[model samples]
Target: MARLALSAIVMMMAFIAFTEGLRGVGPKKCCFKFNDKPVLENKVVSYSRTSQRCSNPAILLNTVAGRQMCVRPSASWVKDLVTYLETKNVAGANSNL
Candidate 1:
């Protein structure tokens, strides 16, 4: 009886590990290098923050040309871009009202 219970527990642990691995539970997008050049605000379609699991936090910019660029979040250009995007979003939302 003891051996049977131990086997079942081991199997359950293995299954859990297998499922997590298949699901890709870790960060898929991480930024190691940052683009120093400032992108035109109009060219950027959207932006997202890198996963917290990443060693370096960065801003991910999605451009109109469907390119992704990583930039330091603390950079002045990044701050300006985020502010511009936020204002643009607000204006767009207000226009729909």
Candidate 2:
């Protein structure tokens, strides 16, 4: 009886570990439309894998764009991201198509 209980406990532990730890359900990345074209400039990043948080450069950095739109993500955003290299779209849609 004791051996059977021990076996059951071990089995339960294995089940829990497999379900929670060994799973590989990471964030998925996909393309998004920007400036009338698909912008794939940023690499697919996960909240857990990113070394640093998502941050915008200082207002000084955007001095060239006329206005500064500096906003940083406070918390980790777990989701998909389109890599710049993989995403590409033409400027004019009617002519290109």
Candidate 3:
């Protein structure tokens, strides 16, 4: 009985350790570079910002063509695109009601 309990405890600890390591899912995705060329707002399917933990914050745009582009958050085009997407999402959601 003592040996069985000890083995169970060790197995539980090992399982916990393994799960904790995988909790992050994978490495933190950080954008090291950015695209300068502007993309058409119509081509963008969605947009998101990089993690705050990232050293260089950026805007991530997912295009309809299945390509992801990283752009500087401070860019004028990026700002406009974000605004357009926000309003578009709001309108789309309202229509579903």
Task: Give the poorly placed runs of model 2, Cα more than 4 Å off.
Answer: 22-24, 28-97
TM-score of 1: 0.77
Q: What C-alpha lDDT do the candidate models reach, one value each?
A: 0.94, 0.33, 0.91
Query: How do all the candidates rank in terms of lDDT, highest first?
Result: 1, 3, 2
Taking all chains together, each candidate's TM-score versus the true structure is: 0.77, 0.28, 0.76
The list of candidate 3 runs beyond 4 A from truth reads 1-27
Off by over 4 Å in 1: 1-23
Query: Candidate 3, 27: how far from true, in Å?
Result: 6.1
Candidate 3 lDDT over 6-70, as tens digits, reads: 99999999999999989796436779989999999889999988888888889889999999989
2 versus 3: better TM-score goes to: 3
Per-residue lDDT over 1-97 for candidate 1, one digit per residue giving the tens place of the 0 to 100 score = 9999999999999999999888787788999999999999999999999999999999899999999999999999899999999899999999999
**What are the RMSDs of all candidates, in order?**
3.9, 13.4, 3.4
Residue-level lDDT tens digits of model 2 in 21-80: 755554232222112222122332211222222132111112233432221223212111
